[model samples]
Target: MELEEIFNEYILKSEQLIITKRSMNDIAQNEIKNLNQKKEKEQDITGNKNSTHSMDFFFIQDVKSGETTRYKNIRSTVDEKIKQIVLQKNKQYQWILSESFEIFREFLIKSYAYLGYKDKNIWPLKDYGSIILSEIENKDYSFFLEQTKTKRDVPESILNIFRNTFPEYKKLETCNKLDVNLNLEINLIEHFRHIIVHCGGKTDEKHKLIEKIIKKSGLWNNGKYDSKHYDFISSFFRLKESNDIILLEIESNNQDGFPNKYYDVLSDLMNSLNSVAYLIVNEIKTIVK
Candidate 1:
């Protein structure tokens, strides 16, 4: 299978999106894990003989150079490997060939055209090195996933994606720095838009509070919020006329605190909240097939 055929006919690369090589790789890692996990889930759901042994293939959780994360199938056929390789290479291809690399922080709003996604911008360079790369000390590329604003669905799955992407950021900080630095108001909360969309804006009380906050605020284009309500927060940022500002403001009244107790090692990409969106999308696609 070719990259063009798979991504173009299948993957829905959202506009307002451009991923660094590391970020894109993180997504691919997460996607693979998600697929395997789904296979496991199905096995469990059916209670089959294969349940006696654990799957030899599991998502790579370490955030170091993902060289060790390559697929090593014990008995996969040619067709299966082709599909896997496409997913694998596509992840790296998006970042290595992102459109935003050239003009500093200028957002390139066009798909790779190499793969499949239409007129969607690749990840911006300034946002990566100047912004995320600087904050992270010398780590790997995946470390920058902390900067991503992903949708909500499988919490475990999304967390996995972030964990995988974190190291990539750590690694890239070695040789690059943003030419023009700007303060980015990073809002790491998943509740900002995802929760409101998951349950219709007016479904219940918790959701209503979300709807109320979003309505009173000036974020909405007219009266409508996101389609799924879990759109990436940055996917809808308002840029100033001067092209010098990235407005990322949060308006949550409730006191949100991080215990920092449960925080330990990060999970693999399949468990990532960010990466799970693609996984679910893939899963659904498989179902449709």
Candidate 2:
């Protein structure tokens, strides 16, 4: 596809994914609210109440067991639903990142192909070639050489390839730096993607990443509370703004002890990916001319 066509397709698909994520989030939130309301009503009816008369032993035992089972079922269902929603959201989040990356890579390949580098053996840049080799069946040196024949001995990084391939575009230097920064910022997302795909999103790596993010947010300082970390945590988590500064609340029983709203995190990630992709694509277009 043409560059514009590829970009539009990506945008359309990404937007649809975002919509689906929001819908799933809304469903989860609504279910939680309804459950809370039901619990409140049940409590109102049952709280501080005593039986007027003593009942038969077995009958009372059965009644108590039934009530216990009812409450247990409610809690179990809510927890299960929340877990399912979170897993589904994480899956969607991973898919969005992977798909966006794939689209970007496709754009790169197509751009090179457009520049008359049509040979399949010459198209995959070295960095990308190594990644492809690791995933594919062929693990031979000859396969690697064939895939990256254009610069086999002196393989170039993606940034180096972009820079060397199109030196006439001076803006590529800054754009390449932006890409590096974007990749760093999105590394956590990538880690989550890896964990979700390979470990069912319940690995120690996920926990470590979560801890790393928490530590970086500066919320905990030398075993003391620091109110100043609020803005950083908020912005990092894309939480609500306070005095024009983003702030997040650490809630107990949330996913990974963070806010249960990973939908917001995924949304922030999607926005970043879209913005960076736009910038890179436009920069590449400038080089094409």
Candidate 3:
């Protein structure tokens, strides 16, 4: 397929992903509202505003011993239910963001593959150009794109691969467009992806890679000054640093796990990714001859 066609498909998929996230969030918010209404109804029936209802209880079973361990009063009230749902929805956000990064990564890989397929003159290593082109034609560019899902420095690694392969890549407008904040946000998204997939959204605060991105993004630097720079990163999520561990916590009010203008935040992140992808594709159009 043509490079532009490939990128167009990627952009469509990215848009759909954002739409799906927003739909799911709307469903979640509706559910929360219903739960609150139910809580109020139950309160009126009981004639006590402070009274709590036991809506559900949770337990775990021990298979070997044939014994069940019940957690008392867990998920018993509307408040608890709301909390659990919010946390689960936050996890869903992480998963969606993870998939978003994957889509972006694949777009990059495909663009490079297209270059290798169309232009042998631009391959950095003259001796192995034919072999690389053959591999790309066979849909076997894993040698170039594999291991790109590593826990850290993913954005830089992607640029490095292209830069090392085509020395002119460093001079490309696409490269120049990848300013520090954009790179920082891309890597931050990758880190959040790693936390959800590998660490379940919990990791040591001293995780050097995560800390580095946070510091560079001005999210936690200089005594936590509120910087208006990170439009998407700051709005969608916040770092909860405590007990020497970092958490992938969604920023929210005490009553809800979603922040004000939550859907806008998701759009902001998706739009930034889309903008970056658009820039790369435009540059690829100039090179793929």
Candidate 4:
């Protein structure tokens, strides 16, 4: 397939997965309408100094006090930064989708082998180019949305939507490993996803926290997050017998008894950070909102 066809298909597939969450879908619509250039905008906070547009756009009300925000809007610099970050994230998201498609393609090719197809016809299943592009109804083409009937993907889209809507989240420090809490949280999320998808659905406390966050926020509620890798976490870190006692398991996943498998866990001591990331994020929102 042509390069344009490949890239376009990737964009289409990514958009489909992204549209599962209304929050993200809405942001995409609004942002696409507002911006022309993909590069970050040069923020002009002075233009909206009277808070006219800000007041109209964002609805932040203090439920108990019967009051809303006094300021019209947050800083304009923040808004532009948010747009920039979102653009960056969109580019990164494409890479991840393409890479994962490669893996999924290999699995499909293996299926052909079961039917006695030779490698000449199967050809390693490399070209996701045209197959992904052939489209039908917009609603019918959704991957997980069609698969899962009762739920939606919200939490998975939350961080992304937040980045798109909130400029502060977009202005993260890049390459500064020591101070990047969000980066660390992302790593934790990836590990959790991998474990759950690759291993059987088992979990310890950490895995449970991931599950709770996803459920509490009504994100990815189709039950895909409950992976088998959770079992590894529970088996190694969580106390199977004790109901009340909560403790962090060791850091290194290099324990002697752990079943020799493809994935491993933590670097040193599986130190419990003594908190839930989603909850912590919510608490901060509570104060600010």
Residue range 1-289, candidate 2, lDDT tens digits = 4567657776787787778767766776686677556655655786722212112222222555554222221224434554555556545555665565555444444444333222234234433444654454444434433444343322113334555555643343334644533433344445444554666544433234555544533334575544443333334333222111111122345556554533355566567667655765675676555
lDDT by residue (tens digit), candidate 1, 153-255? 3332332333343443223222224321011111112332233234321123444444544443323567677644323333332232221111122233444
lDDT of 3 by residue, 235-264 (tens): 333434322112223444556554462234
TM-score on alpha carbons, each prediction: 0.18, 0.51, 0.68, 0.21
**Global lDDT of each candidate:** 0.32, 0.47, 0.61, 0.36
Model 2 residue runs over 4 Å out of place are 48-108, 115-159, 163-180, 206-263
What does the lDDT read for residue 176 in candidate 3? 56
Using TM-score as the measure, which candidate wins?
3
> Could you tell me how far off, in angstroms, the CA of residue 104 lies in candidate 1 after the best superposition?
3.1
Ranking by lDDT: 3, 2, 4, 1
Q: RMSD to native for every prediction?
A: 23.0, 12.2, 6.6, 21.6
**What's the distance in Å from true for residue 188, model 4?**
4.5
Score residue 203 of candidate 2 by CA lDDT.
48
